[model samples]
Target: MALIAIFILRKRNSDSGDRQSSNQNPQGLFSILNLEGKLVYDEIVRATNDFDAENCIGNGGHGSVYRAELPSGEVVAVKKFHSPLSCDQIADQKEFLTEVKALTETRHRNIVKFYGFCSHARHSFLVYEFLERGSLAAILSSDAAAQELDWSQRMNAIKGVADALSYLHHDCFPPIVHRDISSKNLLLDLEYEAHVADFGIAKFLMPDSSNWTEFAGTYGYVAPELAYTMKITEKCDVYSFGVLVLEVIKGKHPRDFLSSISSSSLNTDIELDEMLDPRLPAPSRSVQEKLISIMEVAFSCLNKSPESRPTMKIVSQQLRT
Candidate 1:
């Protein structure tokens, strides 16, 4: 019901307030439905100790995320934007609003849950469900954590992302394009289930509108065509998903593997064993076959030509099979 109310508000304000200036003091512009604006705001500030460093959980290009536990014992992640909008902060305001718009529209099990957002003159932030295991990048960086993420868990993570992307690209009206789909944007729960997070640079592909936009995405996961085309498409996400797949399998960013592939020098006969993460033992026979199939689908997604890349729908279907 809150999501539905937010959607209605977004539609009503689409033409005007959606692009409102960040410098303006728009007091009590809380977009959350069914929650008292001032009450939730007070709870968040009190819980986070006024966004102190001790409460901080994660930091990103857009803002820092803090762990907040309300008086009701509900835990949430709060992404607070840096104050005093100037130059880059102005752009960050746009990104912040973009994320609010995108997340408010999306609803999927594999996608991070969006609770609400607050836009006050003093501080602005977005609230989301707290995920226990943090990010895939953090997990892969730790040997102990990487070992804990067994082959079966990794497979589920990959499929969850594919399913989320498929829903974003096809199931949503005006199909959303998540320009950034790097491992850092993928969060895991206690069960190792993957959830897609971060939509600071996401775009909605509206019909009869040019989807051209500035280049944005993690360097290693960015699509090759973006340098020249300057266009946003679902294929950009597909390419990033390819990189994520290999990263999950290799236990780190596959920079060298990506380079070889880009140079067209990658050996087709390269053994799968060499690509797997060394921290974990080999997967079972059935799981290995699934991994092989997944790798094939990933490679197809990373094709130099955007048109040649498989749609997320196709990739999701392939993974399911």
Candidate 2:
């Protein structure tokens, strides 16, 4: 299998060299993927055993993520798109390009690093710096892993994500709406620090516009009002971030809890302890205060009214202090 991958990758590289010699820019679709060297692409193909299922670490709506270790001893996550461009729709192609653009253009500690990307004839994939701890959803789902994530770590993860979202919604020019913000999209490192990933559905908020578009987000994490409005806004990501905060603190999906609290009556009656995850012991006094503050901000973000939801920048600023 390894030898076969190498031969295939080498042939692909030779073919690419020939194409580059003939037409460097083929209809604006083919260009060097932000990095010099076709060797990186060849190495990645070899690293993943030609993207075999055994190398796959995770899968999402549009692609499967595989763990690849380069010859330099650095490991990376390779997301291989599944038939993303086969469709005639320009939007789908834009989404793919959007992800590449979003990652390449932005730089933040809480945002995943973009090594490079590949838009080859055989396969298309994006390479990202690997996070050892994997997705927060996977960690929180496992009792053993969840136990290792203490209150402080969980709190930091929430804050990290907030900062990242703030950078996207406020710091980035034209502003980027994640469109999809869920536990599955929040990756954790060895320290349990959160890094926002997956920008395939991200949209740029145009000036003097609502940036309205079709619904494109996870079920539970998507903002409630999006169903009626179908308008993509920064608030959509805000609502999803709120759900993530609760999920991290609670150590599980907060679907039932959210449902119960959606009614104004239950909102006031619900105790902090009741909403907290019972799997772990209650947070200490100092931690409790921060958690309380986080919960308050979270509820505000979850406001059914998009206008009522605080911007991610506000959320980030509050969490920082």
Candidate 3:
């Protein structure tokens, strides 16, 4: 597990004295939410040049991501929320913050390290450890990068995501359901290690509360059951993980293959070699067997019936073996 350094910015009351306290920094820009960390609010604004377009690295449904390099020479990814948010967007921001607070209590190696968040009147955003390699989707889109991510690395990436999901589903107190698990949400570090990111729609499965909600998650990766049922479960993530595994193996989205498999009742006569990405050379016999095993696990996870899909814990254990 990685060490979490949590920092939060709170609006100081107008009546409050300007004098800095032990908990507040000299600027009084941020307060310690949990653990230790001094995330100077001004530093981020300057680092991102007031969220200039040149600093922007990625864009998502919720907000844009910017790369901010602090004065200390530390690089981090900043997700700046769109200001003047609509009523529904405000609700989503609240849920996003709540989820971040819960995640700070638990840390996993395969999960992205969240430094903290800011909620100033001017701008609002979340900070996370930056990965040089970027998202899995970006890498697969490039032929050179895809070839660099060989079979061994791809397998490890799949396992890392599974382990992270397992921890989130079974280890967390209330158990978090990562509503979105597409390749775009999976990031890779310099060493090709996978880290799960983007919790914009994540939900906690509280035992006594209803888990039903409006439809969420990426289109193709979303569980088929979600289209008809508003209720959410960990199985949704498992199904997305199945799609991700196939995507990583194929070096692209497996939309056609997935459609064919679902229609053909998961034809067992398909050749494993034919299914693999052609960009790389053929794997050895031992590697092929492992790939076959992984594909089997992915297929099981993609079962049409949510009840038939295996839990992330089970999927993680299967990948480990």
What does candidate 2 score in Cα RMSD to the true structure? 6.7
lDDT (tens digit, per residue) of candidate 2 on 1-321: 011233234334544856322221222323335455533667888999989999999988778999999888889999988753543535545566678767866899999987776666567788898999999889988888988998989989999999999999899987888888898999999978789999998887878666778878898998888768887888888989989898988888889878876544227445789768787887888888898899989988888888888998999899988
Which candidate has the highest TM-score of all?
Answer: 1
| Models ranked on TM-score | 1, 3, 2
Cα lDDT for residue 196, model 1?
98
TM-score of each: 0.89, 0.87, 0.87
Error of 3 at 236 (Å): 0.8
Clashes of each: 0, 0, 0
lDDT of 1 by residue, 107-190 (tens): 999999988876655677888999999999999999999999999999999999999999999999879999999989999989
Model 3 residue pairs with clashes: none
TM-score of 2: 0.87
Q: Which run of 10 residues does model 2 get worst, by summed lDDT? A: 20-29
lDDT of 2: 0.79
